[model samples]
Target: MQCSSYWFCPDVWTAVILLILCRFRGCVSHLKINKYYTIKSEMAKDFPTRAENYAQWYNDLVIKADMAENSAVRGCMVIKPYGYAIWEKMQAALDKMFKDTGHVNAYFPIFIPKSFFSKEASHVEGFAKECAVVTHYRLKNDPDGKGVVVDENAKLEEELIVRPTSETIIWDTYRNWIQSYRDLPLLINQWANVVRWEMRTRLFLRTAEFLWQEGHTAHATAEEAIAETEQMLNVYADFAENFMAVPVLKGVKSPNERFAGAVETYCIEALMQDGKALQAGTSHFLGQNFAKAFDVQFLSKENKLEYVWATSWGVSTRLMGALIMAHSDDHGLVLPPKLAPTQVVIIPIYKTNEQLAAITEKVDIIVKNLKAKGITVKYDDRDTYKPGWKFNEYEFKGVPVRLAIGPRDLENGTVEVSRRDTLEKSSFQIADIETKIEHLLQSIQDNLFQKAVDFRENMTTKADTWEEFVDLLDNKGGFILAHWDGTPETEQEIKEKTKATIRLIPLDARPEEGRCILTGKPSSRRVVFARAY
Candidate 1:
């Protein structure tokens, strides 16, 4: 039998492994000494500027800011504590909104029986390429090799697929729960991780596994289901604008882009700093498709049996990517006040331990007052790092506000306040520091949103002719409002030529007579188009 023992490795190979790890240890020690500051400094030296390359800037910021890192598994990421903390803030805000909309949280299984997938033909077709299937029940040591292998004798009669989405399993369970109209309008949501087996992945943007909340609601009629869909879309738009401080366009997806198994899909799209569009969130009007597929029937008030109408809406951690690309600058992340894990970081400046102790005392009082006013504050009094270094670190991490207190400031009864959004610094009196910080945070949030909106408006342009559209796409690279022939053929042809997809047709688009940019066919209204992440 071949040995599975690690000690059986050839001496040369073992020596090579040890040499590599020894080199890695030195690098890791350097990184640990300065923490993220070392990463930021290295990024400053080696990474491309945001203007030079937005994609590289993004990857660099995600890593240097300690948001996330690529995992050992291909197409996967490990969200660092800081990143997960921001995600928790998002979850908390969205959870409140979902609960306010009469939706209750529920848990769903991660694995779906293979049979459930085939029930929805369109869904299976849409997700088939990305599905991760589990074919065997057990693994055993290989008789002829060193490592374990699948146990053929333990293979199951049916395979299980890791959930790409929970619709099939949820609807199958709904059939048993909804026997009467009283059970109609069953609003449930689940916060879960899903696997999509992505071919290529980026941290929060397109990972193989990501965290998200999926809301599935049952309705008595198509009208009710449609209303639920729109309501959830509004919720997402509201959250995006108010909490994330990112303005979004509320729109309907083109037929070619509608969600799988959905009759109509509604979404809120946000323009990124790079002029690309990112889908912040989506709500789908399923319109009885899932119900019909799973035979989820309900008895009506008139004693009639009918299939239930359905809707599903979701927002994922991809919003983290959206937030980053929408508002971040060349320095690093520019997190909104509401979503920042630590909204304010206070650093103490001093030459001696005595000076540090005195500054800490004042910082404690300020922190207490700030916390009382619902501000998340972190006091960095660690003697290992100087105050200037701490300031740069927090700025890179996108803390909305930073307060610095020195011995001179203690005598003056003031603190130097820095706003991350504008990179502006000012001195504020300690008498009402909490109130000042509160207003400053709101100002920073508003400033970031307004800045993004202005950038989007300046970048957006209307193109009446094909030449103009192509020029804008090649040069300006923002949203192009152009007419379409309302045909999939035209859409596909434009995408093939320009690599720009119809991000959406604005819900509020006015009717107009024009020609399609690509085919010059008669068109009714314009749609938003952009190259996306």
Candidate 2:
């Protein structure tokens, strides 16, 4: 005899046995299943490989790893707790660096008077397209009483522009703050959110609203302002390389790519795993442009009144996107230890309560010791999910290190350790486990940075002619060092043809004579070019 539910029961006898068991156990009541099974092996089946679809793989990994998701509002995202935690770590580290550099934190109004923007013509022109304006202040009930409507009677006499970038408004305020050379070099940094009405947005990469830190400084001399600009660029490079474990090339932007109204723009560009470049951070030397526009005059030590020299520099949440693209793998994120919120996770494998309790006791000691060493550790001993499920969760989320111990291991006084960067696993004695893990975390951090450095070195190449440049960009897709005629027209033409732009002119670039790859005109030095994010 055969059962009607053949999938569940292969024979009538099996069905009878299940029914009898159900009578006593109530079927599903005693059986526990993990809620995240969908994201485990089941979702892995549908996960796109990086080579198959790099963009889709990134989108899927962010969502699957519980990092972030698209919000209801268009061109915006809801960063999940896990994602925000990582961001918080970045913010804390950066804030310390800013304070160490003689910059004090301050706040500025989010709504700038429309007239303020008009003071700097080029600044306004650069951000005009992305500004969000507030016209009316109050909302009133609809006449039909369905919903609220903008109150026509309450319209503001002067329109306000949402802060896309804070140059205009900040400079306007500086006019009143600077009266003498003693008041010069007002180094202020603001950690705040700004809105830019972007038409196309990607999570953490480009969004309508984002959080950042902007530093605005006033100097009595042009040399002082230029020094400030370069100092901040170095700060950004240090944070990117040491904290985030991303290697970057320090350089200056071309005239076409310079920040609007800036005399010079300095930047750090990083190479991603997909052979694309990302501008990790930027600093701009305003060179008295904003001060002159807003009439922010300071009395110099020489007893002459003159416009103050200015510098403004910033780094935003876009670094999150860079971190993801640089180190994550097809399985999920391969986070560096310095930036991983949970640097280490410990799980216990057990079939019975007694066994679990024994493992937990040993894990508690390890956790305390690791925390004393200032490590962020999580000991997940939830019984609702099996040990295997938790292992997959930590692996996918990119916890730098993981440890598992069971009754057998407890008896043997050993634990199995696994590292996310290499997916390498080994058994180790439980004695001095915390010391081993601390060393291992540092090893992982160093290993990840070295791996990225190796990748960038292999991907970067030189192109001496137009054919070589185009071929490298089309097929090779990394940094292409090529000659340009040092003209905006030639740069624009190159972009129109190949969809690639100059990433930067290396700061250390020597004066090598060559011909422009496109125009065959005389050129000074080779600039780094690539298709970018």
lDDT for each residue of candidate 1 in 1-533, tens digit (9 for 90 to 100): 23366544332211110000111110100000111111233434465566666677889999999999998877789999999999999999999999999999999998898899999889987877777777766555678866655557766677788888999999999999999999978999999999887665788988889999999999999999999999999999999999999999999999888898999999999987777788999999998899999999999999999999999999999999999987777678889999999999999889988998898888989999999999999998888887768877898899999999999998999999999887889999998899999999999899888987887788789999989998888777778999999999888899878878899999999999999998888989999998776
TM-score of 1: 0.92
Top-lDDT structure, candidate number: 1
- The TM-score values for the models, in the order shown, are 0.92, 0.91
Runs of candidate 2 exceeding 4 Å displacement: 1-43
Q: Judge candidate 1 against the unseen true structure and give its global Cα lDDT, from 0 to 1.
A: 0.85
Q: Best TM-score goes to which candidate?
A: 1
Model 2 over residues 197-273: C-alpha lDDT tens digits?
A: 77667788888888889999999999999999999999999999888999999999999889889999999999887
Model 1 spans with C-alpha error above 4 angstroms: 1-45
Residue 276, candidate 2: how far off, in angstroms? 1.2
